[model samples]
Target: MSSRLALPPWLRVAAAMFAVGWGANQFAAMLLVYRDEDGFSSEAVTGLFGAYALGLIPALLVFGPISDRVGRRRVMRPVLVLSIAATVVLVVGGHSLAVLLVGRLMAGVASGAAFAPGSAWIKELSADRPGGTGARRAALALSAGFGSGPLVAGAVAQWLPAPTLLPYVPHLVLMALVVPIAWHAPEPAAPAADTSRHGHEVWRVLRGRPFVLGILLTAPWVFGAASTSFATIPTFVDVDVAPVAVTGALCGLTLWTGAFVQPFGKRLGDARLIIAAGLLAATCGLLLGVVVARTDLAWLLPLVAVLLGTAYGLVLVGGLTAIELMAHRDDLATLNAVFYSLTYIGFAAPLLSTLALRAVSPTALMAIGAAVALLTIPAALASRVSPRR
Candidate 1:
């Protein structure tokens, strides 16, 4: 398969993107394992979940401009190596919290470093493809990787032996295969004419109102709501009805829905409206979650997943569109880094929700989430109506 597609640079980059995303989320389903076998507190598990973002944010910030200057492959190669190292850490030392933290952190760094440049690479490689199609493909690859990671890990952990160790083996093998492909693929030339200093240009793009408002009002919730659905909801589901496999399936469903619906979001054209509608859908989903928890109707979990997933798709694509429209060509990677750095904050959703749960019932906590989503709607609408700069 590799031989036949040796010249397809986008394929190699897409595969590596998928692997990075998969590695990032592989630990999601294992949060339960940590709670059950290791007796880690919910807070500890959520912190582990957030650790990825902690490492990811810095890497995104640092790597974006570096890739812009040095070209994508140079940045991607080392990050791919870091990705393999992360998996090895998980395979060998997953039992220890400290080790798990290191692994998650490395996974974050890998993701942060690779995602923007890899995405930009895919876009450049697919320049001959129809408008926006490259972006969709990149998003789909990452989403598939993100959604499938936990599902595979959960199923293996539930039915197969060596739950922790085995789940990572496949990813390690995948990384090994893709690393050579990434190295062999052609590197696109960096922009030749930019005279602006990196930090100044990055800051200039970031200070634009459209980009700032779009990211501030919508980007965080895209993953924040997703983390709640994937990381927190599964743990809350009735174990009898929603075992490890079921939980994993739910997480996958949420992500897959998000992935599939993104193209439609691009077609919607109005970023503000898309953001508003997404927040509304997410609000409904969270409110439904409150009902499901109170009524103990686990069957409705799928409905909640759909709503939240749709919201994720709409908000994500919408925000990306806005950023892409706002950014200068040379500064795209840096802009992506800034945008994604804010988005990664959503990884803390599980931890924040768990913390909220201590002071209020699940129902109340979800209600709070719903209200927050509601509040964002007006801001999104306002942003949409605001004159373009």
Candidate 2:
């Protein structure tokens, strides 16, 4: 008999819920515009984005492994409740920077809550299936959710009659739909027989060298790509074009290229090779951005967009693959949390880089940004290190 079962209705529901919850990050991008239009300084804009990550730290540290011990479904329902409240806060209190920060923080906590359990849930759902099926599903779900978030937010902002209000209105609708499904999602397995206290699970996992290296390697790849997609290019688009369309296009293209191109990039087979391809793609894209800055070439925008988007997509897929191959199963969620924590820290650099652009040109920023993306190559290498027999 086949060890596999159907995709399982509950898993599908959970994946969808995870995607919707994760989508909040895309909406936070809108805060960048709100900050500038409201005449807030760069530091203020940085604070706005930073709240999302701050919310994640505690959740990732506390909630992630707890779900591993408790059932994932149990943890998800409350997160949705929190997400709905955050969306409501954004809709009502968007004018104030402090309110925006709180909203972003709540959104981040939702994301942190969703990621590990969602990933693990997808894996468990596919455990009886053929080779690596769960990973693929998880990857597709994450990419789709992530890619859709910005598109949804951006499209509403661009075409809707009421830009600000419409963007999150759909999110409220999604929240309503997801919460019930989450409540009903099936748990395939009982908690592990060894239901020990999770008190020091984080430190236990962090002590592993491979886990630590994987976390460090992840920073450059995740942060570099995230910073570009979320902060740097958004700043550029806001400067050079109609704020809504340009921001929408940049994020939409970045996400679409990254996701849609994964099938082709995956054919390369070796995870390391895929990571290399992503690094090279981002390097070339960054270089193109620098040249466009130098030549003042408006036409080159599309080319740079495709390059970075594909690069980011490849890096994301590659990072997950590498981490899975490198870490022990028990360490998986903890290691991922550590990696993401560092990755969020790296996310902050672009905002700071944006501030630096006050003294320097965008060309200079592109040069520095591109260089930062390239540094991931070495981190990727380090993560791939194999112990000698």
Candidate 3:
């Protein structure tokens, strides 16, 4: 079969997004290796975990516009180089903080560059598939990438000779496989005028009830819930399996389950119940975390992963679909960038919860998260009444 026929156009673009996502998240399960084997302090560990966002936010803001003006193919083609560079640095850096940070930052840049363009590209390619097919495709690609990294890395790190170095190899191989597709993915430049009104345009859209009540209120918790499941919960509870392996399994399960649920989320959104359902699931997941934290119940961790995973998938797809329904054609990348930037805010949840654990009990801190999730459901549901014209 021809390469084009073997891999559908949309799936080709999705490959780039997946590879970047794998680079971005492979670090999550390895946090254990960094702490236990590398002898880093808690603050430094948090720094390593949180470093991606510093590079990511600016990339999402800047590269999305560049892609819009130039074309997705132009912008996305170079990110794989950065992704490979990041992994190589990670392999060579060993225990050096500066090297690790640089590696993560490079991965963040690749992900940021890939996400906006990839999201826009896949959606355009999938235009004929179905209403929410694009959103589901994007989410599934990203979630699968995110899940696979930690899953493979955790297992490799547990059994392999060099825990840190060997785990990143598979991602390099994955990226190489997707290079042809990313380079040739079909997105012709639309050539809209770049204007000075970007900040204003972002604010205008952010101010709208549809975004404020619907997406803004719910989007952050997508990552927030996922991070809580794999990152926060594992910190407090003891699992009987191999340490890094268990952590990686939880991380993988959470995101993989999220990936599988994208279609279900799309269905809920089409029924007009997605926002409420997604937020409610997040709230309940947090509440369940509180219970698990209080009881130290390792057995329930998988359940926690499932619930939050479902929430993550639902909120992610819902937010994307919401943007698709509301944004103008020219505004798609910018709006997606904005929505994505918001979601990364939730990436801070695990760090924040860790810092807070010094003073507040884990259960109490998690209850607060549940409360926050509960508060957003109504706002998100109400926002559906008004969409940008």
Per-model root-mean-square deviation over C-alphas: 2.3, 4.2, 2.0
- Model 2, range 105-132, lDDT digits (tens) per residue? 8888887777666666666666677433
RMSD, candidate 3, Å: 2.0
What TM-score, over all chains together, does every model reach?
Answer: 0.93, 0.85, 0.95
Pairs that collide, model 3 = none
Q: Which pairs of residues have clashing backbones in candidate 2?
A: none
| Residue 260 local lDDT, model 1 | 85
Ranking by TM-score: 3, 1, 2
Each model's C-alpha lDDT? Answer: 0.80, 0.64, 0.83
Query: Candidate 1 residues 1-389, lDDT tens each?
Result: 55836557788888889889888988887887787778899899889989999999999989987887888888998888899999899888767999989999999999999888877778778778865556667777788888888888888877888776887777888777777766766776655837556557657656756655667767898788788787766555676843767767777888888898888876666878777778998999999988887888878888888889888877876776666556555777777787778878888998988887788888888898999999888777766323223
Pairs in steric clash, model 1: none
Instruction: Give the clash total for candidate 2.
Output: 0
Q: Which one wins by lDDT: 2 or 3?
A: 3
What stretches of model 2 exceed 4 Å from their correct place? 1-7, 10-14, 130-132, 190-215, 237-241, 327-329, 385-389
Lowest summed-lDDT stretch of 10 residues in model 2?
A: 1-10
Candidate 3 residues 102-121, lDDT tens each?
Answer: 99888888888889878988
